[model samples]
Target: MSPAEQAGTQPELTYEQARDELLTVVQRLESGGVPLDESLRLWERGEELAAACQRWLDGARARVEAARRARTPDEAD
Candidate 1:
């Protein structure tokens, strides 16, 4: 694997990392100087990164909801 894949672009990234890279992707897209093929690739990458971020968020939300449900009734007192 490439160094980037082995390190930065690995099998997973944390929510913050994914979101930061997505922000950079958006900026590159908005700057509007890339060739068509590279732009398409960047757009697709942005979509993937966005999806990864959503997965992290959804997992966090589910955990929070589960914890809330697990709380003892007396805890609300």
Candidate 2:
């Protein structure tokens, strides 16, 4: 488990925050100088950040869909 999960306090990262961190992780991994252990750690962190970004996107999509439904006229009169 990750430190945040173990601590039971996942940080509330905004989509942008997660995306930025993920980008950094990818860059570090691509640079090809990190030790194997550190590379693995960065990969794990990248996965977590990707999941966080996905959650944010999913939430935004849901909200947009809901708003669209609300604005549409109900045909079942």
Candidate 3:
């Protein structure tokens, strides 16, 4: 299946799943066995997966920060 098709099949993958797939894409690109054209295609897919993973991380960080702020006790003299 094409990269776009494969990616569309997993629109809501967890962070770990996206990360692992991104890593695999990177390794395939770096292995130097794929043709230049194929490598470029993989690179593009890797970029998309990385972006998805980053979005997940950013959202999680925001949630954690919000939770921390909610629990922090106010300082008093």
Show pairs that collide, candidate 3: none
Error at 57, model 2, angstroms: 0.2
Per TM-score, the best of the predicted structures is: 2
- Kindly report which residue stretches of model 3 are placed more than 4 angstroms away from their true locations once superposed: 1-10, 74-77
Tens-place lDDT per residue, model 1, 1-77, is 32234345657777888899999999999999999999999999999899878777777788898898788465656
Q: What is the TM-score of each candidate against the true structure?
A: 0.79, 0.86, 0.78
lDDT per residue (tens digit) for residues 6-40 in model 3? 45655566778889999999889878889999998
Alpha-carbon lDDT, every model? 0.82, 0.84, 0.79
The TM-score, computed over Cα atoms with residue i paired to residue i, of candidate 3 is 0.78
TM-score between candidate 2 and the true structure: 0.86
Ranking by TM-score: 2, 1, 3
Q: Tell me the deviation in Å of residue 67 in model 3.
A: 0.4
